[model samples]
Target: MEEQRVRPGGPPAWWGHGPPWRDGADGEERRARWPWRSTVLLTAFVLAGSQIAARGQLDERAALDPFARVLLLIAAGQLLWRHRCPRAVAFGTAATVAVYLGAGYPYGPVLLTVAVACFNAIVAGHRRAAWAALGMLWAAHVLVAHRLYRWLPPSGDTAASWGQEAVTAAWVVAIVALAELARARREQWARERAERAQGARRRADEERLRIARELHDVLAHSLSVINVQAGVGLALLDTDPEQARTALTTIKGASKEALGEVRQVLDSLRTPGDAPRAPAPGLDRLPELVEAAADAGLAVRVEGTAPRLPPATDLAAFRIVQEALTNAVRHSGSRHARVRLTREAGALRLRIDDDGPAAGADAGGGGNGLAGMRERAAALGGTIEAGARPDGGFSVIAVLPLAPPHREEEDR
Candidate 1:
């Protein structure tokens, strides 16, 4: 019934959405409104400037017309709501700029509002819409310019009929294209950030699965043997006092061993800041593990001397044997088992055979025990194959690399 607890500061399984405030109402309340506040202030400044320009145009000495002044005011007001509806604001501002220019309002600072609106529309992911708005503004500029100036070209232009409208359209198109490029760059950055977050979550999930598999292998075999011995001790308590006492002693020893194994498994979850403890069982503990299995009423035979292995390889070997013996005692109902460990050229081979009940003759008796053993071996750069023998027995075979293929040997 043990559960895995997520450690604080560990990488999250998934990236969170939006800003911190969007994640929770409480966070929203605590967040500062500085960005929005600054936006409002800047907007007020722009509006004030626009009003000043309008007043200057309206002065008696100024050559500006009244109609052009009115168009400038309308464009400035619509820009105040730009963030709410960027596309609409861009269209309104562009139209006003066209009208003001046609009415001879000097067409100077008034065009700045139209430029700002175009930038806002493209940045808000409305590139096509911004282009369409630009076209409409160009058409308006042509119509008004032609009507107000009596189809005569402006002072600098040659007296070509269609050249003025073409020049105006080109300018609007160039401005909109620049804004679209800026928007595209921003979108690329956002996409990169999203991809990095997704990769982090995927790696975290993989780590979680690996940890779960290791824990299952470590706990399953040890607990099964302990449970069987305890059951035997309880059963013998009434009929045979001496046998019962012996069984009880075995139970105590098995319980202590199980506790040590459990502690070893849990210790892996500790951080570097935590206190250190004794090292976990490795290849050195193989003989002791075999003895423990014998005490649990399974006769185990050990073969060939094993080479010195890395801690990870050694631990994987110990667990594989432990799981094999546990299976024999639990499912096979057999009293005898044989375990062989051999150091070959570049690999360590482990073979365990048990003459348990024929019915359950399979790797760790074909349940969680075998699956856990296979998982352990695989984690240590090893492979395991378990099945029933033709002679009414179960066998498990594992091949583990002594050292990683690409890495040089280090102090073990």
Candidate 2:
């Protein structure tokens, strides 16, 4: 089977793990069903209220007609879609309540569902629709009051008292306010989650870049040595057996060193249940790096004592040196290179110069070696410059702060 390659800059697989409710459309669909379920529960309450009013167990003026009962049930049914189409359902339920009140029916628990519809509108971010529905209810009550006072016989009673209408308005406003408050809280929570996801993606990208730098440093130097020695061995096999044998031995040693470093890189990625990993390469390992570069036919002279460094700075500095040497060996025709290190004012300075023919010696041209070194330096709050010198050769210089960034506290 072909290996699955994760695209560069893609979010890591681990970041994709979380509660299913936060996965977007599917979770919204699941949550949308709750309003309907709530409507089902509210139906029982509406039915009981109607029964009590019909039997005169409660207010006799609030007894609902059979047609008004049908209308109430219809309004309750409209509540089922409140979450999916909050504005539409709010308007439908409020209109049904209005018609029920205007048709000379006694007011009962039917309009109670209208409060829920308004709440759903606010929860669904439709505050305007919720307000509009509340306004329509108030107007309906006004018309009902006017019809009773201006036209009804003085001997007869109104379908609903002004006190009842005022109470319903208060309930509608309260429910909408509570729903809007909840909506605000939900929005805040979503914003926080999005920010966290962005942070995780950034950290993942930085980690992948660090690992890429490590792999490039290890493989580039080791492979360059192996390639050069293999060519030498092939060239001298016919006449100079001892030189060819020495070249073959260098290739074997370089390959072994490359395998060990690459294995360490992979081990760093092992799951928690795996065996403990060996420590990463640091400044102390520069000898091995220098030897590998020398095996590739570059004569290298080291200067200055390596510093006792923080883990991040140590790893970054080592990679920078390794990448610089790899470039010197791989890209240059010269035989000698110079590496100088200095500790000054709480920072480490590295300068690498090679006495090579400066043809096509652009540092970052067509390769990530120089760019990786620059990234390592910048990540440590430092700077790197790689370019051709004024006289003739190429040079790589970097300054790395010993006081690592706050992220270094958390470790790899």
Candidate 3:
């Protein structure tokens, strides 16, 4: 079986999540029924309006005979399929209107059917077809009204005035121009909707990445400390009861702190618009990282100080340092690491190094740690470099902008 993808804040595609234009014809067709209400109303209007028009022009045109009424019905009925087959309905209505006029029937709402069909066709993106259909109808009316009137029409009729033809031409231009306007407006609205959807998807992706990074940094650093302490506790459990108790105490503190941070991260998801309960961890929390590293048996020496910073930049800097130290604890052979912070004019530089021979092949946790660190830095228009130090050690350096770019904040 194949799995289907679902969008956040929207149903699956198969659930018909959007408009027919955005989704497809199948979904719209499924929801469609006979256009009975509209079609019936239009037909009645054309029939009744034609009767009054024919009575008024009783001497100039044919009476509203049964045949003339049928022609009007056919023209109006063509609108029933305007949405399903716009081009066909457009041409069909125009053709019917032309025939009704060729037989000298009184002009009434019959032309309205053709206008409505042409409008739907143009709005449905069949511009050329609708234009041609209306043009053909106009040309047919011209031929019958001018040259074929004597042979085709009831009794005796004269050629239509050039002024009337000009009026008809202008009407045709107006209809086409109006449809073009509607089509352009619809297109602009669709573009805006699509951009809004795209932005929503982008923001969703960024948020998911942020949560994952936060969880990784918090759990990885905490778990590394807990793992080391757990081992120490078990090793000295019987031989040195006091030392074992102290190790257990460290583990308890690390686990409790980890739970608090994890809960904070989860709280943001529960109430997205609410302010965080605790201030986000920043360089101000450096002592916590140092204390945690010491518990993990990795001696960490910190150098330099960072000025107060924006929440986003501060958080990124804090996470990068935490992840770097976590990696040092888990991968480096030596027990010592050094961290240096250099504040430049508009940036903060972090450099972390540990003497190493590399604990194992999977020492860097297969690159997720490094990738997460790099992502944190890059999100702030910064860069990160980590590799083996030619002199038997590993080093990670990151340069982060003090102020994040405007677009980056919008993305968040």
Q: Rate the local accuracy (lDDT) of all candidates.
A: 0.66, 0.74, 0.84
lDDT of 3 by residue, 118-198 (tens): 987887788889999999999999999899999987888899999999999998999999988866665654555556778
Over 4 Å off, model 2: 1-23, 27-36, 53-60, 102-109, 146-155, 158-166, 269-276, 359-366, 407-412
Which prediction has more favorable lDDT, 1 or 3? Answer: 3
- Predicted model with the maximum TM-score: 3
Q: What is the C-alpha RMSD of each candidate to the true structure, in Å?
A: 7.9, 6.6, 4.8
| lDDT ranking, best first | 3, 2, 1
Q: Is candidate 2 or candidate 3 better by lDDT?
A: 3
Clashing pairs in 2: none
Across 76-195, the per-residue lDDT of candidate 2 in tens digits comes to 888787656778989998999887766545556776888878876765667888889889987877777666534532235545577877887787778777877765655554555566
Q: Where is the poorest 10-residue window by lDDT in model 2? A: 1-10
Q: What would the TM-scores of all predictions be?
A: 0.71, 0.83, 0.90
